[model samples]
Target: MTPDEISTYEETLGVLGDIDHRVVERVLREAGWSPCGAGDWAVALRAPDGRAAARISPFDLVAPYTVALYREAAHTRQVPRLFAHRRLVGGGDLQIMEWLEPVDADEAAGFHRALAAREPEVAELADVVRRVHERGRRDQPWFAPKLDDNPDNIMRNADGRLVAADLFGADGPRLYAAVVDDPHLVVTTIPEPERRFMTDIPLTNTGPWPPEVRAAMHESLTTADTTHQA
Candidate 1:
């Protein structure tokens, strides 16, 4: 989108407030986001020390939502480090987050193996998912599984642990609960792009899950369906 259009979209998404456009222009200029691109937002800067990346968004409130959920997920260690959140004086929201390298296919495969192995550390993943579910039950927000589960959003630390990155989607709380209640249901129904992205690592088939996991998944799906009906 054009820069002006991007500004408009940011306003629509509540990323921007009714302030002088010059303020936003200044931030963009200082941040080196002058070289604009199509998407509703732009990556403004990579932190001087290279610890975080600052991004600006105009369309779809994904980034801000992601920041919000990431903050919540951080409490339970379901997500990586979140640096900062700020509203631009002119327009749009700025999200600064710790920079993380995307997980590659091979790495993703390893993560899958770790999950399947059910090692003690793997329990952390389940705990993260469970925390998300508890938060979802309490908040009832729309959740986007793809964003949460995509390999691109997964990261590895120096210690070689898998951590979630992005968070933007629908209601955070509701979606988190749905995932915990029915892990496979959402993953299975995801569109082709997301499905392909997530399925790159071959996890066990949900059709024949371990009894406890299966029961939990069924319960999640049922809760989601019932929520929709109500």
Candidate 2:
């Protein structure tokens, strides 16, 4: 791999820590995703045009979980529909989902302003979150969402409907905790199911505000005794 490839591949490793590196390489080879871009949390790959994307990450449960969270998970009419997923088969998880267009720049900017302000708090987060956990299990429910409500995730097309985009991100567990920690991220509520769930599970998967989020991310990604991040 070239330096660029190595850099992106390392970001992939950052998201899939604990999994053997060789296995991840094989999975990527078989999956045949054309590389898009990657950051600290995960790597982005897409199938040929007109096909859904398949993102590989450490968060095995989030994809199916998101599918179940949204009421219209089946229809891609409004949001990106998760077509399928592989739950950590061979030490890696693959999420197959609809390819959504980028959110409108103006609309995204407006939403970002709202995020920075945490204005007009929405109470719906509790319900939405509850639904995700409820459907996240094999016997019961499903989940898709990047924890951060970065306006980039909320997109729209010609029809003016909200397009659920950028449903991939950094560490799954940390992302979850970040959402729970911030009342402004999604919705605010005193009663908490995820909080209780987090405590109940001994070993389970687990932010910061906009500008602060980046800083905190840098802090977490910082490697000791080295200027580079992991």
Candidate 3:
């Protein structure tokens, strides 16, 4: 997508004001979006067109860094093509982008291990990773990931390129559980005016949100900062 198109998408999304977190999924389902499966930190939905998808976090997570990374790396093909990103009116952020199918973890891990062996394709993957890493180190504080161990982070685009996906935000699940348990934390944790926008939003997840998760949230929220703009 062009830069102008991205800006337009951002504007269009902002106009969808005040989406309560409680009915967010139901809303998407009713709008004809289909489940594209979920990961530990967030869930995803594919648009009716099937070529595009959206990733939703109960609260903002990696979209800030990921979107910026993709924009900067647009010429490199190492990351997914991001189309649009905007914070939900209630809480969290929504990221729409080109949908990619994930490669099997074992297969991805094996390919990663073969980097040193210099197989042409593996070497290409290593080159791409290095480029994205260099950009991340230079521009993003939230871009850290243990790529060597996490093979599930690898995905293949429609063109068969092994691309990196969800390269940050390991703290997502714990933070989400905490928010789900005590929705008021949305007011206390996320900084000012943004929290005010979600005052009436309720979480849909029913939980045995363990005490440790809440504890983790309290500890992290002190330093919590999530951004919607790239």
The most accurate candidate by TM-score is 3
- lDDT by residue (tens digit), candidate 1, 68-168: 55665565454666655655432245565555555786776555555446457666654555455445444432344432444555676434556665533
- Overall lDDT per candidate, in order of appearance: 0.47, 0.44, 0.60
Better of 2 and 3 by TM-score: 3
True lDDT of residue 54, candidate 3: 78
lDDT of 2 at 2: 38
Expressed as tens digits, the lDDT of each residue in 1-230 for candidate 3 is 45785576567566766674445667777889898776544578897877778787655434566666667656757678888876664346678888788798887776567653656755654555556656654553333544434687677888888776665543434435555564445435455444432213123333334567556654444334342221
Which lDDT value does model 2 have at 137? 32
Looking at model 2, residue 15 earns an lDDT score of 71
> Number of clashing residue pairs in every model?
12, 13, 0
Evaluate residue 52 in candidate 1 and report its C-alpha lDDT on the 0 to 100 scale.
49
Which runs of model 2 end up more than 4 angstroms from their true locations? Answer: 1-32, 59-61, 70-72, 90-92, 109-130, 133-147, 156-161, 165-230
Worst 10 residues of 2 by lDDT: 197-206
Error of 2 at 77 (Å): 3.1
> 136-219 in candidate 2: lDDT tens per residue?
432322133324466666765445666544442324454445543543331222122222221211121122235565454434
Q: Model 3 off-target regions past 4 Å?
A: 1-12, 18-24, 110-149, 170-208, 211-230
How far is 43's C-alpha from truth in model 1 (Å)?
A: 4.3
Which candidate model has the greater lDDT, 1 or 3? 3
Give the lDDT ranking, best first: 3, 1, 2
